[model samples]
Target: MSTDGRSASDSTTASALESASFVRLVTKADGDGLAASGLVARALAARGTPFQVTVGRTVATRTERAQATTGGDGDLTLVVGSTDATNATRLDTDDRPATLAAVDHVRDLGETPDLVLALAGLVAAGVEPGAGESEWLIETARERGLVERRPGVAIPTADPVDGLAHSTRVSAPWSGDVDATHETLSDAIGADLEAETDRADDADASGTTLEHTDHRALGSVVALDAVSAEAATAAAAESIQRVLKPYATPDAPFETVGGYADVLEATAQTEPGTGAALAMGHDAREPALAVWREYGRRAHNALEAASTGRYDGLFVVGIDDGPVEAVAALSTAFRSPEPLVLAVGAGEAALATREGTLPPLEGVARDLESVLEGTGDATDQGVTYDVTASGRRGYLQYDPAVDETTIIETVREYQ
Candidate 1:
């Protein structure tokens, strides 16, 4: 079924699948990086390849170091989002050494990989193929005749739902059950291809549920309990790989965080009681408490309204801490039948609420404005307010309900 001219049971498929590994990098937290990661992951998943993905600066730095010392072990490394690839070791121009010292190191131990698939952006930005410190890499690949270039291929890089749908159509496994599942998901969420696609490629902008879902699904598979704009993209992609594995005919081993919608829905169904509150905090001292108070007020009102028996009796639990602690409190509080919980703060609040850290108040207002006005680009202005000498006390006031645009615009102007 593949170019290797071997049956599925033959070692060819297994070898191809096993010999591949992935390393992802993003130039920034923009739509392009998200789309690229989604597309590449989909391709690898369809081919039954094993991979590991990492994003952000710290992860990227570690990945580069590992690859340089690992030697060329039949692995296909995909680096995404290399805005400035000057310091990259695997790429070279002329006088540079291109040797991936890590790959080379691993090769000496008899673990040579078959291919190295560097994302195009990274390739374009890295040390121009054999100039400065990259000469070693270019020359080595040339000597081994292993530098094969494949161009003009545009993979369908979109959100998880779109990418998965495309992959299902192209790969050998197509089923009515899968189609029905997709249709059900789309209809349940009122999602159309064009709209979902737009949300997926929505630049650095933010969106509501629909927009957030598409964006999140593109990056990773996520469990319903873990819902945050930051984590959704990655979670969705991860989920697709997991759901598809059981049907892979050969029964490939796959894992993914389950969906979170069910959890939210289930929590909403519980009777209102002394539940916990989840809040958001930015500066941790002044604004964090203010935000928590607002969240508490809103959550309490929502819960109370729902408790009227016209809807499910969900309670609100309030948490005042950093994002991490907030998420933890949310997780802990949700286990009981608390009436309401408000999580506030940065790290603690994020943990308690189970929603990633709340964006800065100004950023949140800007994002909300973008959603309401149907514009994708909203300027983010750093908040500046008078604070005590201890930096532990300050006053921040922005009405989320009134003149949201003006407030954000003012912040931007001052910034």
Candidate 2:
């Protein structure tokens, strides 16, 4: 039972998928692809996610990613061959690289998983991915087949096979042999699904198969832009609830009789991720999550098959989330070396820095290092700004104070 006097799994198993949490991506900059990176940062800004587009080898080791990809059009590339790129330990230390490269050379193209994994790695570092960046990463992750991406959730797993097994199963209905009929249909569907995975070169590669048998009716569900997973599951579960009558036995108490099998990325021989079993204690909750998981698996399988046994979408996923909106995210990155200027408020003041550049003048912060390198004076929007140097830092003293919160909020629509 739960603290709310309900089965704990009720929330886990019965609840339908609502909006899921995702991270706003952040990475150590290798001083390359500033234009592309700037574009991506700007894109985030347009969606209310301001980012500071700065350059440095913040990623513990540059060797972690084979080729670093900026968040923009594919033309930009950052190859890390510097002395700092010496460690293979960090890259191989996590399960990300291996899982992302599951199918040898065919899968890990364009550093797609690198970008996704970088964000995942940041979660352990106390940073959260903003809604805009999180959603983009999730959608891209799904498109690349590195993880299951659905409307509200995404999972980049170590094992695609175990990562993708989601099933909603039930007990045998005593009425007409629904269990028997379900098994027959399941077998047929499994075979067809397997056929979908038949590859040209890897004759040994098997087809994708349904995971369960017996009293389960696998409902085919599609993701609607506005509809949540919970809604879909609750709507789908109605058919099952009508089949079983009320029975109150402690050994086999009375309530909803189904749950979704845990979906994960595991090798064939291993079990799927934890808590994937079909059986659940009697309770009344939504079934949308399980359904969504199943659908996520289906989408991955479909993409995998279409990619000629290689998950090709990985390259395209990153690109689709790019360019225009990305340029907008650039405004958030204005960094004036020093805290630039300070905005005053009641008992508090917010410091504002130049993102990368201010509109129409998008240049890599470091590239224009000389601007903050020596003293300068400039005017725009009726305000003249003066800069003075402090060690490697620079200070901005501008006339007519700007509201920090208001400046941050107003600058978000840059794209």
The per-candidate count of clashes, in order, stands at 121, 34
TM-scores, all candidates, are 0.20, 0.18
| Prediction 2 global C-alpha lDDT | 0.23
Q: Per-residue lDDT of 187-240 in model 1, one digit per residue for the tens?
A: 544445344343333331111223334433422222332233232323233323
Please state the error at residue 235 of candidate 2 in Å.
Answer: 13
The numbered model that scores best in TM-score is 1
- Which ten-residue region of model 2 has the weakest summed lDDT? 313-322
Per-model CA lDDT versus the true structure: 0.27, 0.23
List, residue by residue over 172-267, the lDDT tens digit for candidate 2. 111013233334444533423333431212322233322221112232211121123221223224323322221111121111111111111111
The C-alpha stretches of model 1 lying farther than 4 A from their native spots are 1-34, 57-74, 83-415
The lDDT, on a scale of 0 to 1, for candidate 1 is 0.27
Question: How high a TM-score does candidate 1 get?
Answer: 0.20
Task: Name the TM-score of candidate 2.
Answer: 0.18
